[model samples]
Target: MADVVIIGGGITGLLSAHYLAAEGAVVTLVERGECFREASWAGGGILAPMHPWRYADSINELVFESESLYPALCEQLQEKTGIDCELQVSGMLQLALAPEDEILARQWCERRSRVCEVLDQAQLQNLNILSTQFSHALLMPETQQIRNPRLGKALLAALQTNPAVTLHTQTEVNVIETEPLRVVTDHGVVSAGKVLVCAGAWTSRLIAEYSSLQIKPVKGEMLLLKAEPGLLPYMLMCHGRYMIPRADGHILVGSTQQDSGFDKTLNVETAQLLQQHAQDVVPALEGAPVVRHWSGLRPATNDELPFVGSLPDRPDIYVCGGHFRNGLAMGPASALRIARQIVAS
Candidate 1:
């Protein structure tokens, strides 16, 4: 038996395996689909919590701490794997389309100095194409973005090269058998000293027979637009929607938050709505061709906080899912905390 068995090969599970193996623990990770192809790969890859002040103090603290860890993590990943995860520190611009929205944004900035900076109309105009749509904006200087798909592939490569880690892809874990500490999957049974479930949207269903944790699926759809450089330099947010720019001159416009329960299919109406929002924020994008459109399910909780630490009734079992929209942003730190908890116990 291995020291740890991580069920679900998304960012959380992969990171958990990385950390556990680094600590000299024998780790095995199983995934139902290709690693990181679900929500982790489908996300916009924004590293900042959207409006940090809107969340509880604990959530804000967790996000801020996680944001702080990205620099070192990115540097280490690139150095070790020789893969450029495209960690961009260009920052994020949250625009205000109306006076009331501007006032609310200003107040939000006042509470956190390091996370957000309230920008005037002139300052907002200087960022990029967003100047025409909004009179004011909040610039998150410390915020950053990563190429999630590339990061996922890099992680898989890293795990494969590590002798202490074993990765099983296209393997579905049906149920977790706790007495012997074994995970019953479609292929075979994996026995370990402990089990950590990081199964993203399928987390609740994975643990339902054993635990009663309430994890819901939140559907999000995004559109990718190919544009030239100088079209959009940074990320933009307005009214819960956002446009994220990539280094390759493509801007990702997203996303519609619906409670559609595990439906990953994209809808034409939502896609068009996102495209319209992108064009409204930057008219130049109206001509940008729609290169891709996709959807994923975000694991959300009743109170919008991720379930970290141990399972209530089972000591050998643990959970680290239900991150909602901040999975990519919070993956590293969440995995670190979960691993530490398991190791210490």
Candidate 2:
């Protein structure tokens, strides 16, 4: 039996396996599908929380720490695997905020010592891509983003090359036995000294009887549009929608929150609506051809905080899922914390 069995192969699971193996623990990671093909690949990879003041401090704690770790983590991943994750400080421009919201944003940034600038209508007009709909905006100059698909590829390569880690792709865990600490899967059974479930959207269903995490699949649909490089200089957000521009001029316009259960079918109308939203924010993208339309299930909780501890009466089994849309932002620190928790015990 391996020292640790990780169920799920998303960012959290892969990072946990990396940290555990680094701590001298043999890890067995099982994924129902290909590794890093789920939300980890579909996400825009914004490294900061969307609206920091809205979430609990616990969420920010993990997000900021993960943000700090990402530079070194991406550097090491590139050096070891020869894959560039494309981590960059794209920054963010939040427009169309209410007057009270602007005050709260400034107060929150002041408390956190975060660099923020309030741009008036005249200043906002200087942004070439922006529409005249928004008169004022808040600029977060320190926001960073990564090419998540590349990051996923890098992590998978790193884990595959690690001698202490074993990976099982296309393998689904059906039953988890606590007494013997074994997981019965599609292929066979895996026994481990400890089990860390980072299964994301599937976490609740997999451990429903043992855990009451209330994790549900919140469907998010996105559209990718082709634009000129540097057409949009910043990540733009307004009314809960965002446009994240890649270095290669692919702008990601997303997303709609539907309470759809495990449904990943693409909706043509929704994709069209997202395109309209993108054009509304940046007039230059008026006739931009949409390159791709995709959907990913975000693991959501009622309180917007992830479950990152052992289950009740099940010290040998731990959970680190239900991160909603912030999975990419908070994944690394959460993985490191859980790995340390398991190792210390």
Say which candidate scores most in TM-score. 2
Write down the TM-score for model 1.
0.95
Where does candidate 1 have its weakest 10-residue lDDT segment? 96-105
Q: How much is the lDDT of residue 337 in candidate 2? A: 93
Highest-scoring model, lDDT: 2
* Model 1 lDDT per residue over 1-345, tens place: 888899999999998998888777889999998999989999999987766656676776667777787778777788888888898887877776466665665676666666666788787666556637566667777678899998898888889999999889889999898778899999999998999999998898878877888889899899999999657766888878898889988888888898888778879998889888888878777878999999999989888899887888888889999999898888888988998888888
Give candidate 1's total backbone clashes: 0
Off by over 4 Å in 1: 97-110, 126-128
Q: lDDT value for candidate 2?
A: 0.91
lDDT tens readout by residue for model 2, 1-345: 999999999999999999999888999999999999888888888887777777788998898999999999999999999999999998999889888888888888999899999888888888777889887899999999999999999999999899999999999999889788999999999998999998988898778878777888899998999999999889988988999999999999988889989999999999989998888888999999989999999999878789888998788989999899899999999999999999889
Which residue runs does candidate 2 get wrong by more than 4 Å?
none
lDDT: worst 10-residue window of model 2? 204-213
Give the TM-scores of the predictions, in the order they appear: 0.95, 0.98
